[model samples]
Target: MAAKPGQCTERPKSVPGRTAVLPWRLAPGIALFAAVALSMIFAGSMLGLAISRPWLGLGLSPFAPVAKLQDEGALWLTAVEGPAARAGIPPEPARILSIAPLGPGAAGGAVLLTGADIMEEPDVLPSHAGMAAYFARQNQLAGLMAEPVELHIAALEEAGSDTPPPTAVYRITPERRRPLTSLPAAFWMQIGVGLSGFWIGVWIWTLRRGDWAARFLAVAGTGLMASAFPAAVYSTRELALPDPLFWALSSLNATGSLTFGVGMIGLFLIYPRRLVRNQFLFVPALVLGLWRLADMLEWIDGPALGRHLAILTAMGAIIVLVGLQFRATKGDPRDRAALTWLGLAVIIGAGAFVTTVILPVALGVSAVVSQGQAFLFFLLIYGGMALGVARYRLFQLDEWAFRILFYVTGVLLLLVLDAILIVTVIDERAPAFALSLLVVALLWLPLRDMLGRLVLRRREPQRGALFRQVMDVALTPPGHDQRAIWAALLEGLFQPLTLSPLENATQSSITDEGAGLVVGGVGGLPAYRLDFADQGRKLFAPADVALADELRAMLTNALESRAAYEKGVAEERLRIARDIHDNIGVQLMGALHSLEPRRKDQLIRETLTDLRDIVNNASNPELSFDEMLADLRAQISEHVFAAGMRMEWVVEGGDSVILPLANAHTLRSVVREAVQNALKHADAGLVRIVIRQGDDAIFARVEDDGKGFDISADYRGNGLENMRARIIALGGDLSMISGAGGTRIEARFPFGAERRRR
Candidate 1:
C-alpha cells in the first residue's frame, strides 16, 4: 500500500467490489428479446387505426375533409368542409353500430370498425414526408403511380331520438398514393433506430446485464424504439390521419418519451457510483409512467407533460454526467475513457436535436431539421451509448473521436455553405459541386490535419517519446541482460505500482486467477508476473493483456538472440585457443630443444604452461578433484626434477569429490606455481606437498626448506599476495609463513564452494 500524505498508518481501502465481468449469458439475451417483442406488440396495437377494404381513399383537393374511425366504433370528421363533405358525406360525427350489403349488385360490403380490430392490424413500416420511397419506386416501375382504384365504404349511423338508424353505402374512387413518392428516409430511419436500438440493448443485457449502466441503457433503447412507432406508421402525410390513429399515435409518443426519460434518469443515478439505492431508483420511472398513462386516458390535462418530463430528466442526467466527468478525471483510465466517448457523442447528438428541433420550437420558428431527420439523429446517440458501454478502444478513442467529429462537422458546414453559395450566388449545380470540391481540398483537409495534431497533443504528447523508448528496447544488442531490458520495457508500458512474480502462473495472459498478466518462460516456467494493483486504480483489461503478449514475444526474441550471440563468442574463443596451441606451442617446443644445454629451460616451460592454460580455459574441461590432483602431482614432479630438486606429493581423503572446471583449473595453477617457487626461486632441495580433506573444508600445504626469507619483506615480489588474493576471491583462504627454518604456504577452501557459487 502506498503511504498517504499526512498520515503514516492509514491504508487505502480496496476497490469497493470486484468487477466480476462474466461471459455473455443466454437468459438476459432471451429477456431482452422478449422485451422488444412485447414492446412491438404494444406499440403496434395501441398506436394506429387501420381500415381494410379492396382499397380506401378519396381523390379530393387539399382542403378535403377527412374522416376516421374513433376508439368507440364511431365515424368522426377529423377535417370539415373538405373531400368527405364535398362527396355528400354528412358533417356530423356519428357512431357506426353496424353495416350490411344492399344486394348482390352492390360493389362491396362494410361493417362496424372496432378499436380491437384496428389494433389487430399488422404493424407496417413507418411512412412520412413522401410515399414510402421503396413503394413509390415499385409503383413507378410497375406504371401504377397515377392509376385509380375503387374503394367501397358504408356507415351505419345511430338513430336519432325518434328516427330509426339508417345505413348508407358509397363508392369512392381515388388514385393510389404513389408507393415510391416518399423519400426512403423514413424506411431507413425506422430500421436504423429500431433495429440498432433493439440489438444494442440486447448486446448490453447479454454482456453486462448486472451493470447498472447497462440496465439503464437497455431500458432507454427499448423505450426509444417504442416511441418511434408513432412516426413509423405514416408516410408523407398531405393531410391528417384518422381520429383514433392520430390521437393514439400522439398518446403512444408521449408515453414512449416519458419512459425514455425514465431510463435516462435511472442511468444517471447508477453510473460511476450509486447516488441512491437501486431498489428505489425505479420508483420515479413508475410514477412518471403512471402520469403518462393518466394523461393518455384524459384523466388530466398533460398536453406538455411528456415534453417537460423529457427536458427535466435530460437536465438531471446531464448534471449527473458532469459530476461523473469530474470524478472520472481523477479516477480509473477506463472510467475516463468511457466518459470521454459519451461526452463527445452527447455534444454532437444533443446539439443536433437542440439546435434543429428544441431551439426552433422554443423560438416559435420552423425547425431546420424535419421531424423525420430529427428522429434519425437519435441513432447517433444510440451508437455513442453502445460504444461507451462496450468500452471499445477506450484508451485509444480520444484522438479518433476528435478527428471524426471535426471531419463530420467540417463536411456538414461546408456542404451547407456550398448550398447557400449555389442558391444565392451561382444558381448552378456544376458550380456548387466544384465549390464543394474546392472547400474540401483547400480548407477541410488541411484543417483536419491541424485539428488532428492539436487533439493528439492534448491526448498524449509523450506518445512519440514512448515509441522511441520501445524502439530502443527492441534494438538493444545481443549479449545484454535480456531480463533487465524486459523489466525496463514493462516499467515504461504499464508503470505498475508494484511488480512481482506471480506464483503458479501458467498462461501468458490470465485474469480470474488474480494475476494481472503472466508471461511463460522459455522452458515453461512462470517467468514474469505483472501486477496492476495501482494501474490508475483500474483492473487490467483484455487489451492490456494483448499488449503484454506482444511485448513478451519481443522479449523472447531478444533472449534468443543473446543466447545465440554467447554461443558464437564461446565457439570463437575455442577456435582461437586451438589455432594458437597447435601452431605456436609446437614452435616453442622446438626452440626449447635447440637452445644451448646450460640455458634456463624454465622460460620455455613457462611458455608451454601458458599455452596449455589458454587451451584449458577455452575448452572448460570438468574433472574430479582426484583427477586434478593427479595432474598437478605429475606437473610438480616434472618441475622438481628439471630444477634438480625432489618433490614428495601426497593426497588423502576426498577421493570421490568432483570440482567444477574453474575450481579444478585454479587448483592446478596454484599447485604448479607453489611447486615451481619451491624448486626454482626458493632453491629448495626437496619440497613436500600435502592435500587433506576435513568435514567441510579442503586443505593443501606446500612446505620447502631453502634459503629462508623474511615473510613480509619478499611476499609481494614472490607473487604470494597475488596467489592469496585469488584464493580469497574463491571464498577460500591462503596463508604463508617463512623464516630461517623454512617456508610454509597453506590454502583452505570450503567444500563445494564452486557448486554453491553456481
Candidate 2:
C-alpha cells in the first residue's frame, strides 16, 4: 500500500547478513533454537545429579565398598560404609577379588570383579569388559540382597597389614550409601562443550541464513550436544545403577553417537559444495541409525561394536569426500584453504578420540584417556570450523586476532574492576558496579581502541586526505617520480610486507589465497603487487581489493582534471603568442623601415614597453587593486599621447583589495584594444577612459568625442572582437553603444567572486 503525500511508511530493520544477529526471515528460528538449547542444558545437569542420587529412594544404601572406579581401572574402595566399614574395612585402595551371595539366588554364580577370570576371555569382546561387567553385576546383586554377602578383598603390594590384613574375607549386609556432594569437572566440561558447539552453530546459521553449510553445521552441533550430554551421566557413574536405568542411558548415548555420525557425514558431503544429493544423505543416516538401534537391542554381540563401527565408517566417508573436494577445489585457493583447515580438524580431533577411546576399547586395553576427557578432543573440530568461517569472510588474520584479543581483554578488565570495587573497596553493590563501569569506560575501552589500531595497522585514509594524495600523484609528470608517489600512498594504506613489480597480472585482486594484493596501473603508473599485508602478519582480504579500487578511481579522476587544466594553460599561451604576432610584429617591422633615428628610437622604445607589460601581466602574481588601477591609468595616458589624441582618464572608489592576476593580461589587453580602436578609426579627437570600483566589482569604459560608426557592422579587424572575447573570458561582460554619439565600450568585472579571481 502506498502512503499519502505527508505520510511515511517505514521499512523494517534487520541485522546485516555478515554479523551474528539473525535476519528478519530467520529470526523465528531463534526461539526454537533457544528452547531446545535451554532444555538440553537443563536436562544434562539433571542427569548428572540423577547419577549421583540414591537409587530406590532408600535412606540406607547398599554396596558398602564402591569398586571399579573409572579413574583407575584397578578396583579401589573409593568409599565404604555400614556393616563393611564397622567390621574394620577401611576406605582405601583395595581390590574386590570376588562377591558371592550367601542366600537364595546365590548358587547361580559368583561374580569376579576387577581381575582376569580363569576362564578364557571371549575372542570378540575384550577381557576388560569381563571385569567391568563383573563389577556392575556385583553392585546390583548386593543392592538386591535379602540376607547377606561374602566379599573377598585383596590388597595391593603397597597396602600395609594394619586393621585389614593383606587378604580379608567379610560376610556383611550392605546398607549404607554416600550422599551426593558434588559433580565432577568432567560433568560440567561435557555441558560446556555441548553449549559451545550449539552456540557456534547458531551463530553461523543466523549470520548466513539459508546456507546449506551453516544448516548442516547446526545439525552437527545438535549431535555434539546430544552425544556429550548423555555420556556425561553414564560415563561418570560412581558405583552402580539398575539394569534398566543403565541400559536406558547407554541407549541414549548410542543414539547420540549415531546422530553425530550422520551429521558429520552430511556436513562433509555438502560443505564448500554439495557432493551428493539431499536424498542420498539418508543412506548413511539410515544405515548408522539402524546399526545403533541393533546394538541397543543386543543384535550385535560386543558392547559398542555398532556405535564404533558406525563412527569409523563415517570417518572413512568423510575422508573420501574431503579428497574429492580437494580435487574439485583445485585452482580455487579460497575454498581449498577452508577445506584444508576443516579437513585437518576431522583428522586430528576425531582421530584422537578413536585412538584414545574407541580403538583401545576394541583392543582390550586401557584407554590413553578417560571417555569424558576424550570428548575434549572434538573441541578442535568446532574450533577448526570457526576458523574456516572466518576465512570465508576474508578477514585479515591480524585484524581478526586483534578483535578477539581486545574483546577478551575488555571482558577480563571489566571483571577485574568489578571484583576490586565490589569486594575490596566499595561497601554497596550498586555503587561498586557503577564505579566499575566508569573505570572500564575511562580506561579499558580507550586502551582497547588504541591498542587495537596499533595491532591491526590498517590506516583507513580520510576521503579529503586521500583526494589530496591522489592529486599529488596525478600532478606529477609521468615517470618514476609519479610511480614513487603512488607507491608511497599505497604503503601508508596497506603496509604490505613487500612490494614487487607485477610481471603479467594487471587487475585488482586478492590473489594467492589472500597473500598478495595486486593492483593494475592507474594514471599510467605501472602495476604492482603488495604481498603479505602488515609486514607478513596478515593476508590481504577482499576489503583491501575494494580499497585499492577506490584509490585508483580517485587517482584517475584527479589525473583527468589536471589534464584539462593543463590544456587550458596551453591554449592561453597560444592566445598570447597570437597577440605578439599581430600587434607587436607590425610595430617592430615599421621601426626597421624608418629612415629617421628619433622616430625609430621612439617606436622601438614604445614597442619594447608594450611587450614588457604584456609579458609581466601574463605571469605576475595578484597585485593590490589600487596599484593596478593607477598603473592602468598611466599606461593608457602614454598610449593616447603616442596615438596623437587627448586622454581623459578618470578613477572612482577608494577600496583596496587584491586584483585578479589570473586574467589581468586579458583585462589589460581589452582596455588597450578599445582605446587604440577609438584613436585609429573612431575619428575622435579626444579618447576618454573611465574606471569605477565598487565593493564587489569594477566597471570601465573607453569612449571618444568623435564621429561613431555603426557598432553592429561586422569588422574584419580583430580589435573589437578581441576586446569583447577577453572581457567575457574573465566571467564579465562587454557592451558597445554607437549611434552618431561617441562609441562607448563598457567592461564589467566581478572581482569579488573568489572562483573568478582564481
Candidate 3:
C-alpha cells in the first residue's frame, strides 16, 4: 500500500510543458540550442586558426603609387628577419621583373610575374584602376607562400628616361609559420558575424518555436556562419593556400551566400502573410542547389561568373518576392508593418553582401574592400529579426513603418554621399563623411521635413467646430432626431473605416495590435468599435484612444445634464396640469349645467370634452394603437350620423401596436381636424375615411365627394394649416390634393420615427 502523499519520502517528478517544435518530437530548450551554436562557433574558430597558421615571414602590404610618387614602380616591403629579407631583398620598396616557382603547388599557372603584372587588370574591360591594380598585386603575392620562389629583381629606375634596367635572380627557400594568436582583425570580424547571427537566430527561434519565418531566419544565420568561416580562412590568407583547398573554400562560400539568399526569400514569402504554399517554399533552394553544383563542376562559365551570376539571381528573386508580399499584405496594417521592417533588414544586408562579393566581378572590376568584412552586415539582419521576436514582437505594431522608412532613407542617402566623396575626391574618410552630413543637413533635410509633414502629420479639425457639433447632439430636443448628428460628429473626428458596437467595453483603448480602437460606453450608450483609422490609410494609435476617452466623457456629462433639465421640465408640466384639472375643470362643468340656449349648451359641452382630452393625453404615458383607432371610428360614425351623411370607415393591420402618448395625441388631433374641415367646407354627400398600418408606417386618408377647391389658390384658411402643423410636429409628412370632384388629405406617420430621432 502507498503511504499518504504528504508523508511519503518519494515525490512525483515535475515535468514542464513540452511542445514539439520539430517533426521528431523535438522540444525547444534554450540550453540545447546554445550548446549546438557554441559547438559550431568553436569548430569554425579552430578551422580558421589552423588554415591561416602558415604565413610568409615578410610583412608585405599593398603599396599605393599615388602615396609614393617618387617610387611608383615597386610595392612596399617591411623590413623583417626572414629568408627573402636577409637575401639582400630591398627593405623599403623593390620592383620585381618576374617571379618563377622553383617547384609546383603555387597558383596562376606557375608562370613568371612582373612589375607590369602587378599593374594589370584581370577582365577584358577595365573598371576602377586602383581596385584592379590591388587585385593583381594580391594574386601575384599569393605565390610567395610557396617554397623556393625565384624573384627577378629590377634596378631602381624611372619610366621614359631609363635604358634597360638591370635584373638579377634570387631564390628564397622555406616558409615560417605564423602563430594562431597573430590572426588578423578581419578573421575575428568574420567569426563574430557567424557566431552572433547563429545565436541570435536560435534565440529568436526558441521563442516562436514553430513559426516558419523564425525557422528560416535561423537557417539564414546558419548560412552566415557557413559562409563566413570558410571565407575567413581564404580571404584573410597571409599567403597562398593549396589550389585544391582554395577551390574548396571558394565553393563553400558560394554555397553559403546562395543559401542565405534562399532563406531570406523564403522568410518573406511566409511571414506577415503566406504568399505561397509550404510545399513550394523550397523551390528557390532547389534551383540554387542545382546552380551551385554546376558552378562547382565548371559547367556554367566555371568559377569566374557562375557563383556571382547565381548570387545576383537569388537577390533578384528576393526583390520580386518582397514586391509580391507588399501587394499581398493590403488591408492588413499589422502584416504590412512587420513586412516593412523585415524587408528593410533583408534588402540592406543582401545589398551589402552582393556589393562586396558580386559587384566587384560586375562592372568588370575588383572588390574595393575585403569581402570578409561584408559578413558584418548579416549581423544587422540577425539582430533585427531577434528584436522582432524579443522587443517589438513583429506584428504587434502598425504605425511605426513610416517612421522607420523615413529614417532609413535619410541614413542610406548619407552613406551614398559619403562613399562618393571618399572614392572620388577626399582621401581622409572622416572629413569626407562629415562634409556629406553637412551637405545632407543643408539640402535633403528640409525636403525630408516637408514630405514628412505632408504624409504623417495631418492637420486636426478646428476645436470650435468640434465642440459645436458635440453641443448640437446634447441640445437636441426630446422629439427630434439626435442619433444622426452624433454619428456625423464621430465621423468628422476619427474617420474610421468601420464603426461597430463593442460588447462589454468599459474603457477607450487601442486594440488588435493598433489595427483598431474600442471606445467605452457612456450615458446609457453602448460601447463603439472603430477600425482602420483615417479611412484605412493609417492605424489607430494611443493618442487617438486618449482623444476618444476625453470626448466620450464630455458627451456623457452633457447628456446627463440634459436629462436633468428635461426631468425638471416634465415635473413642472405635470404640476400645472394637475392644478388646471382640479380648479378650472369644476367651474367649467358647473357653467355647462347652468346654460339654457341649445347653441350655448352645445358650445359648453364641446369645451368640456376638449378639456377632458387634454387631461387624459397629458396624464397617460402610453396609448394602444388599436384602442385609439376603435375610439376614433366610433366618434366619426356618430358625427356623420348627426350630420345626415354617409360614412365609410376602413381599418387594416394594426392588431397589436402601441405608441407614446405624445405621438398618439398629435396623430389624433390631425385626423380629427382633417375630418372636421371636410365636413364643414367640402359640402360632400359622402365621406370616405381609411386608416391602415403599412410595413414601416401608419397611413391615414380622408376624402369627400363635394365641390373641390383649386389647390393653386391659397387654401390654408379652413384648418388645413393646423392639421399640417400637427402632423409635421410629430416628425411625419402631411399632404393635400384638391380636384374637380373633392379634396383628399393623406398623412403618413412612420413607426418609431420619433424614437429613432431621439
Candidate 4:
C-alpha cells in the first residue's frame, strides 16, 4: 500500500462498510480493537482446551488396567483374562466364587469348592472379584498356580441369583511386563510455542491499539495457540476422546496457521513503509487455507501439506520484507534500520526452526528440540517487529548486533572449554578455580570494552577537550583571565560566529534564524548569544545543551577562583601600607623632636631602609638567615661609616637556614636601630658585631668602645623603645649595657618563636 503521490503513507483510509460510517479517524482504531478482541477469544478458548484436556484423560490413559467395583454378596467375575473367557466364562455381568486346590501339589488344579471360599477372601478373587479387588489379583492367579493351572468358577446368569457351577476349568499364565509411556517432546514444544505466541499477540494488541500490524500479529498468535491446544490435550494420560473434538481442534490449528501466515505477510506489506496493496496479498492465504482444510478433513493424504503451506507463506512474507528493505535503501533511509532488524529476526528464527525441529524430524530421529520450543525463538522476531512498527530508536542496533552476537557466542565457548578442562585435566579443585578466574579476567573485560564501543559510538568531541585546555591556560597563576576563560568555553561549546553580549538583542536568544540557546551569565558576566548556523548544525539537541551547561559551570568556578586570588593580592598590598604607617611612620614623627641634624638624618636613613625592605619582600617576606645577615651588615656599615666609626661584623653557622618573615623583619630592624644608636651615642671609633647560631637560638651582640651614658635617661627614646618592643614581640631578648667598655647590645632569637611565626 505505497502512498499515492503528494500524500503521506502513515495514515491509511479505513476498510469499507459499517466501519466507514463512523468518523474516519476513529474507524481504524475501532476495527483494530474488534480484531484484537476476536483474537483474544480464540486464543483463550485454545488455552482452555490445553488445560482441560490434561485433567479429563482425553487421548491417553491415566491409570493402569482395572475392573468395575462389585459387592461381596454378588461375587461376580470381573476383568476376566483370556483363559477364563475361553473356558466358557462369559464376558457379561455375573457373580463369581473363589478357587480351591485339588489333587497333589505337582499336578494341582483349582476349583470353586464352595461359596464360603469366596466369602472368606474379603478382597481377593472369590469375595472381592470386581474392580475393588483388581489391584490385588490383577496378575496374581499365575503365581498362586504352579505350572499351568486350571481354575473353575461358578457364575450366575445375567439378572438372576443362583446358578450351577461350571465343570470346565480355565488355564492362567504370567506374562512379561510392558514398559510405561511418557509424553513426547512435540507435546511440550507445542505448548511453549503456542503460549509465547499468545502473549506476544496480546502485548502487541495492547501496545498498538489502532495499528494494522498489531491486529495482524493478533491473528498469528491466535493460530499458534489453536495449533498447540490439541497437542496439550493429547499429552495428558492416554485416553480415547471423541473424534469430533480432535477434528475441531485440528481444523482450528490449520485455520489459525493459515490466518497467522496471512497476517505476517499483510503486516510486512503495509507497516513502516508500504510495498504492496493490501487487497492483493490475500490470494496465497486463501489457497493455503483451502489446502489446510482438505488436510484437516482427511480428504487428502498430503503428508503434512498444510504445515508446508504455512512455511511457504512465511517465506513469501520474508521475500516481501527483502523487497521492502531494498525500497527503503534506495529511497527511504529512515526505514532502513527497522527493516534490517526484521530481516535478521526472520533469518535467525527460521534457521533455529530448521535446525532444531524440521531437520531432525525429517531424518526419522527425535527432534533436537521440540517445534513449540523452537517457535519460542520466533518471539524475538515478533519483538523486533513491534519495535519497528512503533518507530522506536534503533540507534546502533544494526551496526552492533553482529559484534555483540559474536562476543556472546565466544564467551559461551570459553566457558564450555573451562568446564571441560575442570572435568578432564584439572584434578585439584583449587587450581582449577584459579585457572578459570585467570582466563575470565584476561578475556571478559576486553571483550566487553570492544562491544561497548560498537554499541555506544558517541565520544567526547575534540572541542570539549580544547575548552578544558583553554580553561586551564586562563586559570594558571600570573595570568588569571576570567573573561578569556568564559569566552573560550562558550566558543568551544557553541562555535557561534557572531558572539556578543545579549543586552542589545531584543530577546535573550538571538532573533536571527537558526539561533541555538541563550545563557544568562552570572557573577558580572554578560549574557551571550549562540547561533547554530555558524556551528554547522541546524538545531541543538538536549545533549548539546547539557554539554554546554556543564562547561559553563566549570567556567564559572574558574572565574570565581581568579577573582578570589586577585582580591587576596590587593589586600596584601593594603596591609603593607598600613603596617608602615603604624610602626615606621610614628618613629620618624617622634624623631623630629631630637633637635640635632645628625640624629634626624640618621632616623630618615633608617626609615628609608625599612620602607625599601617592606616593599621588596611584600609578596614573599620570608628570607634565609644568610641573606638576612648580609642585608643587616650592609645597613649597619653604611650607618657606621657615615659616623666615622670603624665596624667589625662576624657571622657563624648562619648559612642554609631560613626564618619566618616576621622574625627576620624584626631582627633586621632591631640590628639596624642598635648600630645607628652606637654610631650616634657610643662616641667610640670601633664597633664589633658578632652573630652566632646555636642549635636552638640566634645570638647577636653589637659591642662598641665609646663613652658610657645613663641608660635610664635614654630609655624613653622611640628608637630604643621600638627596638625593645619589636624584639619582645618576636619572643627574643634585647638588653643595653652602658659602661667604659662601650655599650653592648645583646639579642637572642629562639627557634620556637620562628616556628610559631611561620
Candidate 5:
C-alpha cells in the first residue's frame, strides 16, 4: 500500500468545566494595581535610605553640640564639660578634639576627634556630648548649632613646645563649610521607579492591544529602568560624589531599577492569570509618587512619608491578594489548589517583609541593616509573585522534576564510567572515551523511541491504515465471492479510525487469472482497475476515471502479458526449426535424388513434398523470407479453391533472410483471415495474392474481384479481432478496403532487414 498525505486527528476532550473569558475581571485588575502600588512604595523607601539620613520626630538628634567658651587671650582649653551627659562620659576635658564650623550661623561644620582621648576616659565623657558630636559630623550640624565655634584642644599629658598645635584643635568661631551639593539619591530612585511604572504600563497596554512587539519593547524598557534607580541610589550612598558623575549614575541606576521591577511585574500581570482585582491599588503608588514630589519641593520629608506609606501599602496589598485567592477558589474547584498555593507563597513573602522591614524599624536597629533586610524581603516577594503569575508550577513541575532526575542519573553514570575506565586503562584519554561510549549506549534506545514517536505523531493518523485497507480490498482474489470481500472491506472501514465505505459499492470486474479487481462505485457503476502487482495504482482515486477506461486498461495489461509469453515461446520454436533445416532438410533432398529410375523420381517428388511440409511447419516457429512468401501464397490458393474462384499468387524479393517467428505468425494470420473473409462475405470470382519484401517491411496484398460489402459495417467480430490482435502483437498492422466490385486486404510485417529501419 502506498502512503497518503497526513492529517491531524480530532483531539479527544479530556478536561471539563474549562471556560475562557474575554477580558480581565475587575477584582483581578484591582489586585494587580495594589501589588504595583505596594511595590512602588517599597521601592520609594529603598530610595530614601539611599539619600540623606534625616531625623524626623525621633528625638534622637541628628546634630552635634557646640560649646562656645569665651576665655582670656591666647588661652587653649585642655577640655570642656557640659550638662548633656548620659552613662559613659562626664566632665572629660581631654575628649574635646578639634571643631570647625562654617561662618557665624553654622550652615556647615566640621569636627575631628582623637580616638586616644575618647578611649582613655570614655567613661568620664558626657554621653550627650559624644552622641551630639557623632551626629554633628555626620549631618553637618546646620539646624542644631547657632554660632560657629572652633575648639583647639591641647592634651594635658603631651608637651606643646615642639608640637604642631597639639596635632588637632577645635574651631569654635563660625567658618563657612560647603555642604555636599549633588542630586538627592532619592530623586534618581524616584525617576527610576516612575520610568519603570511607565514602561510597565506600556507593556500592559500593549499586551491588552495584542501587540507582541510593543509588549517586548515595553518590557525591555521597564526592566532597564527598574534596575537603574536602586543601583544609582546605592552607588551614590556608598561612594563620595565629588562631581555630577554620581548624580548621573544615580539617574541611570534609578532608571534601570524601575525598568527591571516594572518589566517583571508587568509580565506577571499581563501573562499567566490575574491574582489581584483592585484597581485602587494604584492609588497607594500614586500617593508615594506624590510624597516624592512633595519631598523634592520641600513640602514634606520623603523618608518619613515613604516609610509609613510603604508599610500601609504592603499590608493593604497582602489583604487584597488574599481576598482575590479566596474569590478565585469560590466557583472552580480545579483552580482552588493552585490558588491556595499562590496565596500561601504571597503570605510567606509578606511575613518575610514584616520581619525584615517593620520589626527591625520598631526595634531601632541600624537603619542600613534594616533597609538591606527590607530589600531582601522585596526580592523574595517579587520572586514569589513572578512564579505565581507565570504559572511556573502548573506546567513546569513534571518537566523540572524529569530534568533533575535525568541530570542526576546522567552525572552518576558518567562518574561511574569514568572511574571504571580510569581503573582499567592507563591511557590519559581512556576515561573520556569510555564516558562517551557509555553515554551513547544509554541514550540510543530512548533517542530512537523518541524519534519514532515524533514521526508517528507528525503523520496523518488515518492515511496509513486507509492505504493498507484499500490495497487489501483491491487485491482480494477473484472467484472468492466479491460480496463477502466487499462486506469484509466495509467492516474493516467502519471503525472510528477508518473511512466509512460508500453503500452498494462492489467488485465489478475480476482479472482473467484472478490477479486484480475492477471495483464499482455505488449502484454498480464501474470504477478503475486495481492490480495486485502494481503499486502505482494507489496513486489514483477509485472514482477518478470511467468504468470503461479501467476495463480497457485491465484488458490491455492481460493481453500484453500473454503476448510477451507467446513471443518467448515462438523464439524457442524458431531456434529448434533452424537446427532441423540446417541438418535434416539438405540430407533428405540428397538421399531422394540418389535413388534409382522411377523410384528415384517418385521418391524425389515425395521427399521434396515432405521437406516442403516440414519447412511449412517450421515456418510456424518463425518464417524465413522465402518461407513467409510461400505461406502467403498457399493461404490465398486455399481460400480461392474453397470459393471456386481462379487465384494467382506472386512473390517478389525472397532472399536468404529469416524473420522472427512472432512476425511470421502475425503475417500468416492476417492473410488467412482476410482471404477467408473475402471468400465468405465478398463473394469474389478471381483472387490474387502478392508478397513483396522491402528494406523495412514485408508487404502482402490479398485482392479479390468480388461483390464487396461495406468494410466498416460488415467486417467486425471474431475474424477481425483475431487479425488485428495478431498483427498488433508483432508490431505490424493490417488494413482492409472493400467496395462495390472488389475487396483488398493488406498486411505489413516489418522483420529482419525491415526491422533495421525501426
Candidate 6:
C-alpha cells in the first residue's frame, strides 16, 4: 500500500546523544594563563635580585679604558690647578697624558703631556733657562709624587711654535702604569652572558607568539647589544687610526644605530597585531653587524674601523628598538599592553646607554655602574611578551607557548650537553661537532610540533564550525523533528561567520505531520538536498539523495491525503442526496396523485412544497463534484423547460472524485461562471459539462449552442474571461471558443503538479 503523505512508515526514535564541549579545547584561556604565570615568575625573580643587590640593578658599566683616561686626566688637571693657584704662578692649560701600549719588548709612547701654555717666559729668563727651570720644578714635583715618575719638561719662548712645548711634563712608562687585570675580563663576560641570555629569551618568546617579525627584531636587538664591546675598543683607538677605517666605522655605526632604531619600531608595530611587512629596516642592521664582524677580523681597516664602532653599535640598537616600537603600537587595545612594554624597553635601554655608556665616554663623568641594565631591560620586555603569549595566547599564544617552551628547553638542554662535551672531549674539534649533533637532535621534535600547531591555528573558526554543523545535520536519522534544531544550528554557525550576505537558492520545507526537514544547498553552492530525522539523531542517507526523496514523498502524501478527504466528504453528501431523492420524492408524488378533485390541487401544492424543502435541505451543504453535477443536470432541465428548446446534458468521468471544501467551492464558482456566461453571452439553448480525468490532467469542458461572438474581440469584457481566470488559479487551464454557431469553454487541472512546481 502507498503510504499517506507526511506519514513515516516506521518511526525510528533511538539515536546517540550529541558530543559535549570539552574544557581543554579552549586555547585562548589556556594561553592567557600560561603567559601571565611565566611573566610574573621572571618579574618576581628579577625584582628580588634587584632588592638584594641594588648596585647590580640594571645598567652598563662606566669603566671603559677611554673613560678611565678622561677621568684620571681631568682629576690630575684639577689637582695641578690648585697647586699652581696656591703658588701664585699662572696655571698651565689642561691636557691628556696617555701612554700607548707597545709591542713585545718595545717601549710604547711616553706620557706625552702637552698643554696650551706654561708660565709666561720671564723677560730675565731665556728659552734655554726657562726650559731648565721648568725641568727643575718637574723634578721637585716628581720627588714629592707617591709613585716614581720621569720628568721631561720643555718651555718655548716663541709663541707661534708649530708644536707646543711640554709644560710640567711627566712620562709614565709601562713599568709605572698598573698591570691589566682579569677583573675587567670577568665583568665583560658576565655582561655578555646576561645580554646573550636576554636575547635568547626574547627570540623564544617571539617564536612562541607566532611573531616571525618580532623574532627578527629580537635578533637585531641582540646584535646591537653585542656591538657595544667592539664600539668601546674602536673608540679607545680613535686617535691612532687612519682616515678610511675611521670614516667607514663611523658610517657603519650610524647605519647600525639607524637599523636598530628602525628594527625596534618595527617590533613595536608588529608585536601585538603582527602586520608590518617592511624589509628595508633589516638591511642596514644586517650590514652593520657584518661590517663589524669584518672589522673585528681586520679584513677592513682596523684602527680607523675601531674608532666608530661604539657609535655604530649604539645606532644599530636604537634603530631596531624604535622600529619594533612603531610596529607594535599600531594595533588596538588588545596589543597595546605588549607594545607598551616593548616601548618601555627601548626607552630604558637608550637612556641607560646614553647615561652610562655614551656620556661617560664623551665627557669626564666619574660615576661607575654595572653593565647589566640593558640586559635587565631586555629581559623584562621579551619576558613580558613571552608571558603575554603563554597566558593570553596573544597571536595563538596557547599553541605557540608549548612549541616555544619545547624549543627553548631543548636548546638549553643542548647548550648544557655542549658544555659537558667541552669538559669531557679530548679532541679540540670533538666538542663543537658533538654540540652541533645534540642541538639538531634536541630541536627536531619541537620544531615539528611548532610547525604543526602553526598550521592548525591558522584554520578559521567559522569554517570549521560550519563544517561540523553540516555533518551533524546530515548524520541525524529520519523521523526526527529537526526543523528547530537545523534552524538553531544554521544560526549558530552562520551568524558569527557571516562576512557577507548569503544567497538562498533553494526552497526549504518541514513535513507538516512528521519530524523531518529539507535543506537546499551546501556551502553556498548549487542546490542540493538534506533531510534530518530520528529527532536529528541519525542520518537516513546522504543529504542530497535524502532531501530529494523526502520532497517527492511529501508531495505524494499531500495529494493522496487531499484526495481521501474530498472523497469522504463527497460520499457523505451523496448519501444525503440519495435519501432525499428516493424516499421523500416518491412519497410527495404519491400524495399528489391520490388526492380528491377539490383537495387535489391543495394536496398537490403541499406535496410539491414538501418535495422542494427536502431537495433544498439536501443541497444546503457545500457542493461536491457529484452534487454539483446532479444540480447542473436539474438546472439545465429547468432551462430546457422554460426556454422551450432542445437541450442535451452529459456528465462524463467523475467517479470517485473528491476535493477539499475550499477547492470544491472554487470549482462551484468556476462552474457558475461558465453557466452564467453561457446564459448571458452565448445565448445558447444546449449546455454541456464534460469532466474527464487523464494520467496527467483533470479537465472540465462546457459547451453551448447559442448566438456566438468573436472570442478575441468580445471575450476580454465578457464573464468568460473571469471563469478562465478562476479555473487557472486552481492549477487548471481554461479555454473559451465562441463563434456564429456555439460557445465552448474547457478547463484542465493537473493534480498535484502546481504544488510540486512551487
Q: What is each predicted model's overall lDDT from 0 to 1?
A: 0.53, 0.65, 0.65, 0.54, 0.44, 0.44
> Which is superior by TM-score, 2 or 5?
2
Across residues 1-758, which tens digit of lDDT does each residue of candidate 2 receive? Answer: 65311112344456677545533463424433553446455664656555444431111112334333232334445456556676566667566666667776666555555422211112124333553474466346535443466767766443343564478877766544423433467766776677667656655555444555666667777777777776666555444555555555555666766676677777777665567766686787788878877865667655646566667777788788889878877765555666777878877887888788777666667567767788888889886665544443322132454354345446545665777788678888888878888888898888878765653444677997788688667765566656777899888888886787666665799877687899888767888898766655446777799989998888889889768856865775686687789878988999999999999999999898778766655466466766666556656765666666666666777456766555555667778888878877777888888888776767888889878886556554647887777677777898888757788888997764552322
Q: Give per-residue CA lDDT, model 6, range 363-442, as digits (tens).
A: 43432343333324344444444454443334333444455555555554555566656766634657565765666686
Q: Which of candidates 1 and 3 reaches a greater TM-score?
A: 3
Give the C-alpha lDDT of model 2: 0.65
The clash tally of candidate 2 reads 0
For candidate 2, the per-residue lDDT at 229 reads 75
Task: Tell me, by TM-score, which candidate is best.
Answer: 2
